[model samples]
Target: MSQAKKIMNDPENLVDETLDGLVAISNGLLAREPGSRVVRSTKIEQGKVGLLVGGGSGHEPMYGAFVGPGLANASVSGDIFAAPAPQHVQEAIEAADAGAGVLIVYGNYAGDVMNFDMGAETAEEDSDIESKTVLVRDDVATDDYEGRRGIGGAFYVVKAAGAACAKGMSLEEAAEVTERVQYNTRTIGVAVRAGILPDTGKRTFELGDDEMEIGLGMHGEVGVERSKMMTADEVAKKMVDMVADDLPYESGDRVAVYINNLGATTQMELLIVYRKVAELLAERGLKVERTDIGAHFTSQDMAGFSLTLLKLTDEIAELIDAPCESVPFTQG
Candidate 1:
């Protein structure tokens, strides 16, 4: 039995209304570009790299929350599970330009690629500004299955890009760093249940109480494999192996670990998964420099989780740890 749904309004109108709320609450630290939902930095510092990132709604602290000092200069938000309109993306690029050029980074999804491509063309209208995009297609399951899917690995890219931009790296330099990070990253996910749409009150998909889907998508798209439920440790191992195999990490390889919640999974469950992942990494003689386990990104109330790993070099490690004071992400 599903619990009753309670939202401000219907699902179709959620994105628009939420953006309104976000702007109202950002305290002028953020502002949406004219006729665009991409939150732009009010204080654009000249000669510093400008960063723009975005995706679907419901993943709150993502595309929007990461806008501020040390993060993205702008974010173009989209409807739930849908890509932002191209015009919005262009506006974001325009708003964040600070004479140093802009780096557009985002998750790898079909709609996103299409719209952002269109946005890039629109950006070229201004020859004085240079722009490039880096796509994070780190999901090992989808990466192996043919269609590239964007999952939890996006947060790491955002964090790294944000730091580089804040450090006043040239647009080309920041883009190169972002691309390198993309090549070194991998992710995998599993879902215990599906999410419900506020408007329809329906589960996005069906799964048996005793079953789970491995490699589930954020929009409730069917996963690569449906299997009998396994123990938390077993599930964690399966997830870790899926990602590690894709990277084929050699012994002693340094990495950063991100354990992202899909919405409904509890912190306690996440901790359990992390414990298994840490032990497994040690068994494989790998070193994890940073382990981030939380709701860094999410689907709408979906009961699941994903693991992302980024092979790290010294330079990338410093960028990852760089301080960011975004509304949602703040580091001392």
Candidate 2:
């Protein structure tokens, strides 16, 4: 019943306006399609396979901020927490497609799957541009692998997909690698505070002043467990336990650890949690191959974070180590 506190002019035009500002900030590396919500990067790598990713907006620096030379070629944005239309998806695919075709990487939600599939069909029919799809399913808190939803772990999957394309892999090859990369990844998140929905000015959910919800979805779906707030170390141990156990990562394994801020949580808090996460991984005898920490994917101002682990193979390690540049994510 509480209205959300936020900054803005009109919720109706928030998504488009946000894209406009994004393109402006992109320094001409990105642009919006005429009369649509599709945004594509200007720095396309010719003769290389294209990587495209999209979904609902509101998770800033996600599907949109990821467009650039080394990440997604184009991004199709929908309203906050809403799926994009198939028409717009087709537009993005056409724009992103070069001589080598586009690989569409998105989350495993039902609306996204249906719309992205329809878009792929239209793109092939209209321009003969080939496209393939890879669904990211890394949220271990969900019912099962098949029923799981992609959460913060999507960042790593996008990184792998983009790196695959940058390495000149064929569309099919990139898709295959992306699928495997996703398969090796697992994630779990906890929320201490809910995000405020821009459209209705309503908070995503409610929590007690001193309580936490474990395993909540990116969109504020109820978590599997809720309890009184605990210390950062306690939260980290529980989250890492869920993620590490879901993949059932074995001792002596090398892994990439990503700490994603759900928004509103401070960097200081994140680092504190990371220290514990690193300790936990070490206790399990897993060698931390690489560490990424920041607010890559966020839900407005939700005060929480998620931990993701990618079990590394020789091939996946190479992809993860490969350098890439984008608005929100850039690394070597």
Q: Estimate every model's Cα lDDT from 0 to 1.
A: 0.82, 0.90
TM-score of each: 0.94, 0.97
- Per-candidate clashes come to 0, 1
Q: Please write out the lDDT profile of model 1 over residues 1-332, one tens digit for every residue.
A: 74757567766677777776777777887876344677776766777878888887777777666788888888888876679899887887887787788899888788999998888788878545578888877878765534567778888888899888888888888999988887788888899988776656778898999999998777787778999999999998888788888878878999999999888899999998899999999998889999888777777778899999999999899998998876766785
Q: Which ten residues in a row have the lowest lDDT in candidate 1?
A: 141-150
How many residue pairs clash in model 2?
1
Flag regions of model 2 displaced more than 4 Å: 1-3
